[model samples]
Target: MILKKHLKSIMSVTLAVGLVLSMAVAQPNLGMAASADDETYSGKTPKYVFMFIGDGMSYPQVSSAEMYLGELSMPGQITPEQLDFTKFPVHGALMTQDSTSFIPDSASTATSLASGKKTLSGVINMDETKSIAYTPITEALKEKGYKIGIVTSVPITHATPAAYYAKVANRNDAYGIGKQLAASGFDYFGGGDFDQKTGPKGADQHIYEIVEGAGYTIANTNEEILALNNKSGKVVAIDPDDYEAALDYEIDRADGELALSDYVAKGIEVLDNSKGFFMMVEGGKIDWANHANDAAASIHDTIAFDESVEVALDFYRAHPKETLIIVTADHECGGMTIGYSLTGYSTHFDKLQPVKMSYQEFDKLVKEYQAAMPSDPMLSDLADEIEDAYGLDINNLSDYQSSMLEDAFEKAMSGEKPSDDQEKVLYGSYSPLSVTLSHIVNSSAGLSFTSYSHTGTPVPVYAMGAGSELFDGFYDNTKVYGKLSVITKLDK
Candidate 1:
């Protein structure tokens, strides 16, 4: 009873402190200490703003990536290598719950960030009733003569990016979202192409056709996009290779291919102007890789995301007093945790070095193997290929591990259904052989995932530059916009 009372007292004290911090931010002059002429909330608005969202990144994802890099550089040593954004001067936490559920989706959480409001999951830029639409900070900034750029590693019309410029009752309305993108009047839209060029039924006009008709230049090749400049009035730069889907995972990206950081750098080049610009860069593939429970892919993508933030950091150095950079996430996906049952209190992130490709790439390899071996292929027959792909020596596996592979291999090759509940747990929706491979490799690295969906976890917020001090406290995701509005006074 005494211990319970002490715990209650601690909770009470923490809540009271949080309330005090929130109240402090409510004051108009709580901006960072700066000169009278400095462009802070107390003075003029910041001229440049960059919002970097690592789609599924949270504390575990961030720490794991740092640890992986540290292990790669100093094998078996306890060095702590960190991402650039983590070293920002100010940090806070965001409660990601939307109006409806504790577990939030990208659309709703992103809406909360873009606009100071909460909506239902899968809804974008609209209230829960869907009758009233909320204007995102991007619109307000645009009205203030700031060019807006939206860049992502996923589809341009994906939920996270769309929340800034599009409003739809359902996120699946790809054609509608694409139309909104064409009409958004933003300066730049770079990354993946329209997920659905035509309507869902394939009867409507192509979105690209609409985009071209709306007077936007479309760059589909590397040379075409690289040649673009600030003079290239309005632009939509699509990934030359992955035109229909997301950009390649960092682990699978080929040399010279346009990565997320490339798009962000290009955005900086094109969006720079006298009045300034607001750019939203998303490392979206991190979420997809985590959803598939691929730790190596997730880590590489997280690193790639940090590289994009570094691009902004470089820009900030040139315009320190006039720039603001914020790094955050929509929500945490996959319930990712750093520790694993097999390696308690120890992590061998270097073991992940052998994972040369992502689970998606490995699935293609499985398909090729299946096609090459028409007759009944056995698990033992692909031992050499397994070793080559994931560096997992199949010959050295214990009987129990071999049995698991045999079951997954048979189901993958022969199109056999799981015999019971245990097999279902072994492989859910994903290719059985591929998921099993990821599970084994991830376990070897001392990482694990609890769910294949978004979790009810609060995401981190890292900020720096003008008015960054206002972000140094726990708050709801909606307060992200509220804080930005305070800095720029745009909502007024």
Candidate 2:
């Protein structure tokens, strides 16, 4: 009704008319096209889109990261080599149920992938009878002037980047989705940092002081996002430091930090401008590593979200007729299946690369060893630190994985109150020793899991630049908002 009560004043007058049509065009050096035949592709009108997703990705989490990157290829590569958004040209498969539920949460499948509208289940872009809110392909391309990024590895007000600029009816209400993502005067907002970043406890205003009093500009390390440029101003990096310090589990990041394709190449170097930007990224912890079934941290967060879908397919081969992209997901968590029953059909995905880290960093290494030995913490001294962070072979366990880790270490040292079969094998999760050591190293690399949550399975979309043949065949994820509202032309 009247654009869902002026969704925060239509993002403060569409970023004040996108800084006067981004200072009248002309500034697209988009970089990265040195040699895919020195690229150039032409098609127009899509005017730079994107819209990835991946929160709980499926199709067996993209064929289990293309069979664990084909067992980490390169020694005479016979296979395992399709990533960069699963080599899309066009592909389809959706049907992620939700209006109430059919296993779909990530705020009702990210508000039906940002306002294609199907609502319910802790709505965000409101609609399944909440008296109408919908209109969210980034606010219908912010009234056609565009420019509105929103990357995510998690927590840019969660629920899949707050369903492209909040309209909250309650997706965990992080202080009212951090005041609608600090008044969403949109331009950018990379992920993580705010599940409660100074809001839930003794709250006296501090979502970083209302996202820096709404003027924006808050990067977060990697030297303040590589000393941002591209006429920097309205930003929101948030590369962790609270909200469980996210942007993690790209096989547990280190060194400079900030990854999720460095927040989509710093959100395409500050939303590429010239009235054309509608980003959306996500890869949101591949649904918290399939809610802890953790197939090698959801295949290293789906190959670190295919390095931001190969940085938006190298800016759609340098604006292939004004970009389009797409990719997909928002459903199918641990129904993930890649054949296993102790290797009946064989699938040694390099034994999930010794699981380096993440069952949320072994659930913060079991609360840092129960706060350094809480009155003597020891589940076989943390099961020998999960067999040295998952190289497991726990002296080759498999008498049903050492009797389910000795009945999960005598029901986690008999703290009592946990028997529904020890709450479905360990406090229902938050790292029960990295989910019993990554499901016994993903059942010794043949892999398995049916549910810890989310699964009505379908997810897989792909697509490519301009009008991607309106997302070929099989539909329903609200027809990806009517084929991205006719490839973002925005007349609807």
Candidate 3:
């Protein structure tokens, strides 16, 4: 009896100890659990990083663009060849942006990506107090002996492009930005003209001259850009103002004038040196058109932006493991939403042609229409002209649709609003027909568009090559800067 009792007591004690250990393991401390998942990433350091930012591109914009393109293909089907950046081996989403306010403007978001720090809205490469941030990826890359370049469809002094190089309290300080750009000592910079030479005569009327004097070759045409011998170490500036004439297309409506892809090709040509390079190519105008709710213009610009991605992908294919390419957007513009099935879903987007109207062309058309009707300041005449340009039939428009357009136009003409439904209809919103077509394409091609302005939502990020693994999960926008910095050895 004494032996049995001793054995039983020992068994009870062992069971009690086992239960205590189980409880301890089950209620692990938060810090310990976090540490358990923390992993050190080991991979080849990226020799080249190509970042493509499609300004104002939201998830909806990409989907819509894809659907639109797919509609143009056989049986309204899209293939790998039709995709601009589909070749990226790894893909994920990025937070749209985070500023002092939830809806971040381009200046803050771009600055965050460039400097690895968040700042107030409208600040570029500076903090909330307007002090320059010390950790710009460009500076970091330069410190590590990597060549750096920036290209964009909008003015080089625009927010997204300038954020990479210039520091300023306000993004509108284009003159100061331009001066800084000339002195940045970067190898390549190309884009449209900002109001660079707009002052009164002799009031420093030569910003291009300033750029040229700063050791850049100012080429006004693609031919000039093409003529540039690879041996020249000089910075090349393509005069975006004159690209249309050189290409034999009306500057007002030309589809390709210093296109993002073309600029990317040129950037690669110049910056692809022995030490490797870091290039940021932005389709900056997508946001501008989006803000105006110009659908045709925005979609066309998105397509152009995607073409630039194709250029980077070409480089990626050639370089394979040596290159890292990331395609993403700063934010979504116009609060663009994609679809509502009630609008007759049988139509597909493949039927529409890429819009060809330039801002100038639309302006000219509007003025002409206005001139034709002196008695009526209303858009009766202008509406007819717009219908002709866009192939719209007034008969098909519902009373509500017509009234909405008329009101929008009148407000625009009275200067109460910017240009009205002309800008919106031709480029911004899809008419019933267009929307129906979009749905059709979406059904077949897996594409569609939503809002017409930037949303508070996060955008997607598609990455490929070495160091791309770092971008696999949810991260702050500034973390992209750090990763790029480390990959390019900019952290040195």
The numbered model that scores best in TM-score is 1
Stretches > 4 Å off in candidate 2? 1-37, 53-60, 63-146, 157-192, 195-207, 214-276, 287-323, 328-337, 341-343, 346-398, 407-434, 437-461, 465-492
What lDDT score belongs to each candidate, Candidate 1 first?
Answer: 0.87, 0.75, 0.66
Candidates in descending TM-score order: 1, 3, 2
Preferred candidate (TM-score higher): 1 or 2: 1
* Clash tally, candidates in order: 0, 3, 28
Sum up the clashes in candidate 3.
28
lDDT of 1 at 65: 93
lDDT of 3 by residue, 340-424 (tens): 3434444445433533454435566666655666676755655465554454454565565566556556644554323466545
Residue 487 Cα positional deviation in candidate 3, in Å, after optimal superposition = 2.1
| Candidate 3 Cα misplacement greater than 4 A, ranges | 1-41, 74-82, 198-202, 239-256, 340-355, 358-360, 371-373, 376-384, 412-453
lDDT by residue for model 2 (1-492), tens: 888769879887998899888988533211111111212223357778888888889788888888788778842353777887777878988888876767878887777767666767777877666666665678768777888888888777888888888887878777778778888788788868777666666556777778888888897877887777568878888875434646677877877666788778888888877877889888888888887788888888888888888878887887788788888888888786888787878777777776688777676777676666567554667657777678775667768877776666555544445547657645364434457667777877778886788888888898887878678777667667756765564544
Order of quality (lDDT): 1, 2, 3
State which candidate has the highest lDDT.
1
- Model 1 earns a TM-score of 0.91
Local error of candidate 1 at residue 374 (angstroms): 2.5
C-alpha TM-scores of all predictions: 0.91, 0.35, 0.79
- Candidate 1 Cα errors over 4 Å, as ranges: 1-40, 416-421
